[model samples]
Target: MELLLLEGVTRTIELPDAPPLTILSGVDLAVDAGDRISIVGRSGSGKSTLLNLLGLLDSPSSGRLVFDGQDVASLSSGQRDRLRGRDVGFIFQQFNLLEGRTALENVMTPLLYASGRQFWRRREIASAMLDRVGLSHRLTAMPHKLSGGEQQRVAIARSLVREPRVILADEPTGALDVETGGTVMQLLDEVARSSGAALVTITHDLAIAELASRHFRLDHGVLTPVSVHAAEGLIAVSGPAAGPATDAGEAS
Candidate 1:
């Protein structure tokens, strides 16, 4: 059930007039089916860089990255693309929906690329997904007309439409109000659980991080485990797999 694993992973970007900048270094993480992991970090803490690597949108500069037991470095770009499309679901803070399309159309986009039954029944599949997200009444609503929460829900439907093996949620509530954001996160967690997919959320809020079964903090390109129960009432969930790392309770 190990879906993704990263060991000694490092990502560096070359600068035009300076030495390479290391965005992430010596990071180790494992994601399993039905696991919920939260990574807390601030701006420039390499959270987005890590997200890209997890989603297979980018490769590591060094170290090993294995997705579903295959070495990432050994695969061609096309193979990676196909694998990512088939197994990874992405949710962004901005709810990257197509402005020109309706909610249903946006969800159907993924299945359109799949083979056989999925491709032929893209509309049916997409409609069912929207209904599952409580958007059946607004299937044809345009992005411009939907509220922020509605838009995010549409994005969620789209992500889950493919029934991906893992869900990568990047600051998923950054753009919504507290109440709406809470509702959205609950919906997301419920659907992901029902689908038996691993959920990985990267966020700056400790409150958000506490929802996961295991937590980690990323700072200065280093990843350290955090025990959600060690904060003297700061964390309340008593997360299942969180391990204590020195200074893990410090601000990110």
Candidate 2:
């Protein structure tokens, strides 16, 4: 089933010193449950703008976004907020954790706002989620106390705590080393796949994007699919340096 849908979407923005810019132009997309989609492009290629629109953090200037059979534009601001709170999970590049809060507290933050349960119950679930992310021991540690990889893991836990139907990750591995980034991306893929949620990863890394089941490249406000099969064949014939997941193979 199609869990999310966007049709004829267009978005425009104005800068103080520049003319109005069109970020997204007539974009159309449909994502089903368990779809691992990667949107790859350089900075200012409208990849993040598309992610924001998909996550309902920003409204489209024109077009329709139908999520789970409901027209998001038709909903009131409050209703849209509630929908975002319950149905969408976001993992930001910066981690976006409160400095003073412990890892467990940060994970529990979304659930607390989402669930009407008391503090103790929220803590229990939050701890479980942290354990799931392999961060149980660091539960009481503050955001600053954890390493970069650990902080990102906590962010993943927080996003998954609410068991959202869709997980939107914006440059999630941009801040980590290659090995750590791969590990984190693997964990994210596992969790989202296991939970039967569609995962949308917005990234500039072709290797990371290759790990996704579906890949699309955005250029000049247009999206084009990259055939992994063809890329894989080319890599096989080109030898070791031209591996399937290499930046060159992925960038096309």
Q: Per-prediction count of colliding residue pairs? A: 0, 0
Relative to the true structure, candidate 1 reaches a TM of 0.92
Scanning candidate 2 in windows of ten residues, the lowest lDDT window is 230-239
lDDT of 2 by residue, 96-191 (tens): 999989998899898767646634588888999899989989999998889999999999999998889999999999999999999999999998
Residue 145 CA displacement from its true place in model 1, Å: 0.9
**RMSD versus native structure for model 1:** 3.2
lDDT tens digits by residue: candidate 1, 1-252:
468999999999999999999999999999999999998766789999999999999999999999989999999999999999999999999999999999999999999879988999999999999999999999999999999999999999999998999999999999999899889999999999999999999976666777898988788999877655433424322257644444334534
